[model samples]
Target chain A: DTAVSQTPKYLVTQMGNDKSIKCEQNLGHDTMYWYKQDSKKFLKIMFSYNNKELIINETVPNRFSPKSPDKAHLNLHINSLELGDSAVYFCASSQVGKRQYFGPGTRLTVT
Target chain B: TQLLEQSPQFLSIQEGENLTVYCNSSSVFSSLQWYRQEPGEGPVLLVTVVTGGEVKKLKRLTFQFGDARKDSSLHITAAQPGDTGLYLCAGGDSGGGADGLTFGKGTHLIIQP
Candidate 1:
């Protein structure tokens, strides 16, 4: 079974459209995170949730919100997406301070 | 502010050639991780180095952490086309607790046959 998985392997929408990406992990980890990879392939942490509570929220804009309904799931919702938000979003999970497992990723493109 | 700075934004070399990639940082980290990402896929963990001046080998790939824990290196011998991918280095706190890692921009490598 895939340890980590994300929905919408690819997404294309208008600049003002809103979209949501879902992620799930079966690794039974306590901490889950979301990362954004820009056109330059530079990865940056967006948000982190531990046991359904927000642990870290980077300097990302307020339009990007993360919700964790349970320990195994973390979803990202974007409101009025802009062209700058066109990038790959990755979901990762880890147990405590151990190495993290990353999902295949969701590629979002705003036209 | 990217904590880790990786050298050689892009590299393309012939097979069988040897190359090394460097990851540098100004602040110290408790442990550093190296990840390789292929096209259309998420980055996968290649290895993790915890101690200063420590060296670990995985097949032909040699990973070394600097003495100050502020740098790391990845050396590949006899590069093959299958080795083509994006390499990223990340730094994390020494506490080894709940925290996210700071990643480098990543080095895109292409090995031609």
Candidate 2:
């Protein structure tokens, strides 16, 4: 069974277009996170939710919003996307005091 | 800002060779983790070292944590073509927000057969 999964493995859209990427986890973890990996392969934390509660909110722009409707799901919604937003977004889940399990990742391309 | 620096941004070696990569930081961390990422996939956790001066081995890969908890090393013996991938090191509790891990730039390893 897939422990962590993400939707729309690839997304290509024009600048200023709005998009959303969905993520789900079946590992029954309490903590879910969003990370962005740039072309340089530098992974940075964007957001984190623990048991459906907002826990970590990085210095991402207000255009990027993360919503966790429940402990099992966390989704990212981007508004007015720009060319600089092109990157791979990854979703991960982890139990308290444990290692994280990552999803395959969603590649977002902004033209 | 807390940062982890990975040495040898890119490496390409023949099969059966050995290589070592380093992850260094100026600030201390509560824990450190190593991950391997293949093409079109997210990083997969390989190991986690928490204690100072701790060492762990998985098969032919050996991991070591510095006594100050500010650095770590990954040594792979008998490299194989299947081992080619990007290796990443991350540190936890380096003020990267709550429960966030600060990741290094990563080392790209290409094992040639």
Candidate 3:
């Protein structure tokens, strides 16, 4: 069974369009996170949610929004996507004081 | 500036060679983690070191946390093509594992057979 899963493994959209990537974890973890990996292979944290409560917002742009409906699901919605937003987005989950488990990333391309 | 920095942004080595990847930071962390990611995939956790000066080994991979909790290293023994991937080091603050991690620019390794 997949411990962490993400939908839309590849996304290609035009600039100014809106898109959403969904994530689900079956590990029963209480914490979920969204991360953006740029073309330079730098992974940066965007948002974090613990038990459906927002915990960390890492100076991400307002156009990028993360919503966690429950402990097992976290979704990222991007509005007015820009060319600079083209990158791999990853979803991860972890228990308190434990290592994180990541899902297969969603490669987003904005034209 | 990046909170964590990794040395040797890219490395290509012949199989059976040993190599070491380094991760450094000026700020101290409560815990440090190492991950390996392949193309088109997210990072997979390799190990987590919570205490300073702690060292953990997973098969041919050895991970070491700095005595000041500001640096870490991953050493691979007899590296094979299967070990080729992007290696990342992340730091977590005192908020436990629930907080967002500060990641370093990953080291991309290519092992040749």
Candidate 4:
């Protein structure tokens, strides 16, 4: 069974459109995070949630928002997506003192 | 802003060769981790070092944390074709604000058989 899973393995949308990616973890972890990997392959943390509470918000733009309905789910919503928003998004989950487990990742293409 | 800078952005070597990757940062960290990522997949944790000057070994891979906790290194002995992947180093601070990890850009390693 997949420990962490993300919906829509690939997304292609037009600019100025809003889109959402869903992530769920079955490892019963309390912490979840969203990371963005750009064209240059630089991975950066965008947001983090612990027990359904927002814990970390990086320097990401206000257009990017993350919501956690529970300890097992974290979703990312992008508003008015721009061309620069094209990148791979990964969802990960971890316990307080354990290694983080990641999903397959969703490749977002903002055309 | 806290950042981890990795050296040798790309490395290509023949099978059975040895290599080392370095990750450096100006800021001190409470713990450092090494992860390997295959194409189209998220990174998988290989090891974590919490103490300054700590060294850990996994099979043919050896990881070392700097004495000042500002740098780390991963040495792979006798690398094989299956070991080809992107290596990333992440730093975590003890102060409990975000507990979020700062990751390096990563080193892409290619092993040819």
Model 1 lDDT tens row, B12-94:
99999999999999999999999999988999999999999999999999999999999999999999999999999999766
* Residue ranges of candidate 1 with Cα displaced over 4 Å: none
Cα lDDT tens digits for candidate 2, A1-111: 999999999999999999999999999988888999999999999988875567655579999988988889999999999999999999998886578899999999999
lDDT of 4 at A86: 97
Show where candidate 3 strays beyond 4 Å.
A56-58
Compare candidates 1 and 2 on lDDT and give the better one. Answer: 2
Q: Mark the regions of model 4 whose C-alpha exceeds 4 Å error after superposition.
A: A56-58, B96-98
Q: What is the interface RMSD of candidate 1, in Å?
A: 1.0
Model 1 chain A is weakest, by summed lDDT over 10 consecutive residues, at A49-58
Clashing pairs in 2: none
Per-residue lDDT of candidate 3, residues B50-87 (tens digit): 99999999999999999999999999999999999999
Q: For residues B23-107, could you state the per-residue lDDT of candidate 2 as single tens digits?
A: 9999998899999999999999999999999999999999999999999999999999999999999998743334767899999
lDDT of 2 at B110: 98
DockQ, every prediction: 0.81, 0.59, 0.80, 0.63
The model with the greatest TM-score is 1
Across residues B3-112, which tens digit of lDDT does each residue of candidate 4 receive? 89999999999999999999999999888999999989888999999999999999999999999999999999999999999999998767543456789999999999
Screening candidate 3 with a backbone cut-off below 3 angstroms (N, C-alpha, C), the clashing residue pairs are none
Best by DockQ: 1
Summing lDDT over every window of 10 consecutive residues in candidate 2 chain B, give the lowest-scoring window: B92-101
Q: Clashes in model 1: which pairs?
A: none
List interface RMSDs for the candidates, in order. 1.0, 3.0, 1.4, 2.1
Ranked candidates (lDDT, high to low) = 2, 1, 3, 4
